[model samples]
Target: MALTAFVCGCTGNDRSQPQAVVILGAASTKDLLSDIAEAASNSLDRPVEIEISTGPSHALAQQILSGAPADLYVSANRQWAEAVVDADLAEPAVDWLSNALVVVVPADPTVAVDRLEDLASESVKRVAIAGENVPAGIYAQQALSYYQLWEPLSASGKIIRGHDVRSTLAYAERGEVDAAIVYATDARLTDGVRVIARLDPASHSPIVYSLVRLHGESPAADAVYQFFVGDEARHIAERYGFQAFSVSQDEE
Candidate 1:
């Protein structure tokens, strides 16, 4: 009877353990995290408390490597997750989503900023972009450079800095910036923002999101890891304006 009671107690304790997941994420993933968390909670048979910190990819990576307790990381770019691997903090990075750069204006869409030249006009004075250290900001900078629009745009004194991609989008959505550059994923999050143009995906290095486990691993963490690349999570990703992971992306 003692042995039977002890075994039952252990089983109950195991069943009651909560699945704690911490995501040191980029701002771009904010739109779909709730849906992914819901599916993950169902799979783990425990409530999934996903605490996410949003900032530039580099800053988030440093936070994780510095020993912040994190179950996983979803970065706007693969490089930051790869940083975790270099620090021996996690496994090889996995690309969970593919994204493109986009130019956003106010939801009213009166600017008619349809081309690169349109952006250089004197009327286009202030533009909000992610800070240089941020992934989304870097992409925006690179695209501007490649198209030879950077200098003229910069000379307009309209380049404003957002802490991250989401902040940049917020600037445009709130009528704070005449123009802003953000990921296609960020623009999809709200009806309050409208896209002025869809940037060529090849305009810069591929805009990809990678997932990595932070701290040690566990079944809960693994489920969160898998959820980002699975059909359930992909559905959430699509709804949030990200391209679903191609089967080939899983191998990448």
Candidate 2:
């Protein structure tokens, strides 16, 4: 993504501030930002506006580099963040948060799936997962491949592919897919969804969030950044099943 600074504070008396915060959000983090944006009108003490375009992380990254007017960049993985920083579109990178991978079953369980590995059981006829390109899907693939479940599970013609994490979640929530792979956050949001297992962080690729400030930093932009890394934002994310980023012993 090309480098561009974001507006820092409330633009004076102007009743409407036309702006957009571009997020390479993994289907899970979008809601947290939306809630904060809704309160912007009052909390920002000025006219506030936001727009989001979502897809696979690669797609979002491409959009940003193609001169997409993104005020800030938030990504589901550090890889995308590093891409932007490498391109000089954003400042030095910082990992902001994390989420855990989980297996989900239908809201009304006719087919019972219990463990992360249970997804491969012959009794489970169909399972849904995000495309390999999506982070959630990538994590799922890694975990199953570790357990050597991918080939056996796919051989049964039971693995259905969703375009993104949320889609796979929808499959489980609606009972369209007997089981699905998704982020814990997604499972928490969908009312009919039930979580069967959360992958131990050590069991698969790490789930990390990377946030960067667009060069034209504004008060609103900074506020968004500050809040995301702060306790209030962490709580908002937790309510929806997101595991807040924790400092590792290495950092301490």
Candidate 3:
């Protein structure tokens, strides 16, 4: 229950309680970050209590900039990391993982959609996507724009914008929307949603996850960051459908 409690992106943790490390992560990294946090604690000689906040990368960066107490920050894309660094809220960032975008629909034979462009069809009464500034949403817009579908789709008023990728995925999972654009890893994790199409990697900016330490740091927090970028966490991330930062960086 404690671990589950700490996984939320909102500010619900009791501030008075002593915690070893406080990490602010993007929504897509919730499960992966929690797994790494537990594994990193087990590897340490002493137990370290890790608390994580998960949400849109842009929103998380804004929280850190507005003076939220955080030891480590993991963003879903480099632009948000760059924004934090520009504000001098964090140190230089390092790429941690890579992911691809995909279009998802409920696992129903009734849906005849098969490609990203198909989302513009009249049959798709509703489509879920992250809000304008969220990393996943921005990427989704880029890909849709490349296919020249964004403007018309926006005008049609069928777009259902969510605060983050998870929320967007939730809409698809609950059948609130006919389709949603989210990370491939997110689509993989949810059972009710099935990926209908994979967006071409070249269609948009690279979806690189990055980490940065806050202005004030603690040894325990630094240790957790080190463990996160180390081989152990990298292996865990790969198992969860994330790609190596190095492999994707070269392509970028």
Q: Best by TM-score, which number?
A: 3
lDDT of 3 by residue, 1-252 (tens): 012225322123333333468888899989999998878876754446888778888888888888888888889999989898899887788888899999999876356778877888888778889999999999999988888889988899988899899999999888888999999999989798888889898888988998887777576677777788778988999999999664233321
Considering lDDT, which of the candidate structures 1 and 2 is the better prediction for this target? 1
Candidate 2 runs further than 4 Å off: 1-24, 39-41, 217-219, 246-252
Q: Cα lDDT for residue 165, model 1? A: 82
lDDT score for residue 234 of model 3: 88
Per-residue CA lDDT of candidate 1, range 1-252, in tens?
Answer: 000000011122245656566776777775466567666665554345565555678888887878878877888888888988899888777777888988888887546666656788877778899998889988899998888889888877878999888878888998877788888877877898877788887778898888776658576677667666678788777777788765454453
**Which should have the higher lDDT, number 1 or number 3?**
3
Clashes of each: 1, 8, 1
TM-score of each: 0.86, 0.82, 0.89
Top model number, lDDT: 3
Residue 101 miss distance in model 3 (angstroms): 0.5
Which runs of model 3 end up more than 4 angstroms from their true locations?
1-19, 246-252
Q: What does the lDDT read for residue 126 in candidate 3? A: 83
Q: Cα deviation of 184 in candidate 3 (Å)?
A: 0.2
